[model samples]
Target: MVLAFLTTFLATRFVTHAIRSGRGPFRDASVGGVHVHHEVYGIFLLLGSGTAEFAYRPGGGWGSLLAVLFGAGAALTLDEFALWLHLEDVYWSREGRSSVDAVLIALVIGVLLLIGANPFDADRSAGEGVVALTLLVNLCAALVAILKGRVVLGVVGVFVPLVAVLAALRLARPTSPWARRRYPAGSRRAARSRQRFPPGRRNRWDALVDLFASVPHGTRPRTATPTEPDPEHTR
Candidate 1:
């Protein structure tokens, strides 16, 4: 299933980029007057695979086939994740980068699970209350990290509790909801956060993300306004 998802995602990205560049025979498909997006095909594939799996409860090779189909479908749907996220066609806009982030996050979690990382692996000897408490603590820590704008860390913390705890302990990004609401304006903590994560700062993750997709993805031009630098999303 993982292989199928990765293969389909790579192929879809290649074809879409080729079409955009007019570098190959790949072209956009349309039905009547409406242009069709690849997510449509993915949605159908998911429905068919899911329905077959549930109705027939197939095993062995059939089960594997369904899993592959489901994985491919997921990749397709998530490739346009930004479109559905904002209820608009932001596929080539700056916001569209979220689609890439979504795919990367999915890939990370899927691979982690495949490699035997389990978030629910509590000690059996521990009482149910202990297990429940641990789960709650982990959940709260992950939520805090997310609110602090450590999105990747928050997600990873679900699989690794320590990661979430550490992220929650760290200072929130200057633009994060947590910082905006909790840190008073002009406060020392707010100033420190802004200094730590200045606007337009780039990191290794930014380069890694750009490696998978084209830059400028048809981002809309900004209108004339204050010349202040734009804030960057801390991936």
Candidate 2:
């Protein structure tokens, strides 16, 4: 469980940071991405731990109950995470998510601490303790990130460290940026030309295109030719 949570924490963190620091509203995108990463990896963590506990211990004792409690705790955590994610998805979704999420998180933490404080077989309990610790760490990091305006870091903090490392590797690869620049120079110029207009009735790209095309290549406007004189006026 510890391994699982840590894995998620690291992976989530790296991704969130990458998106936050990238161009545009990448920060918001990063938050959404981190939430996704946590959901995917967090499930694995829960499954692996539950399996391990069942395989070796072999009975529905207090130990099993503890494991079940943790599993439920994780489900609650994810639900709250999802609520927050939805709130971020639409502006109106935020009305009650924060308050509800806080309560859910507090309950998860309480259960985790209770399980950790109980006496149990040292080896197995150690694993459970580790899992609990991971959740706690993730929770604290997320709160800090939200309060400090670095919510991406909090989202990323839910993933394992390896994901973050991998993200860094991908960023450092020359092919990543090179691929993005594959568009022709003319297209690039066109893209830049379109940015002047506000995104209103017309599509944003079209507006930009219109703006760019309207500008003369050289600095001067085209001069109009003089019309031929009328016969009556000339006479």
Report the number of clashing residue pairs per model.
0, 16
lDDT of each: 0.82, 0.39
RMSD of model 2, in Å?
A: 23.9
Best by lDDT: 1
Off by over 4 Å in 2: 1-14, 23-36, 58-80, 83-235
TM-score of each: 0.88, 0.26
Error of 1 at 126 (Å): 2.2
lDDT of 1: 0.82
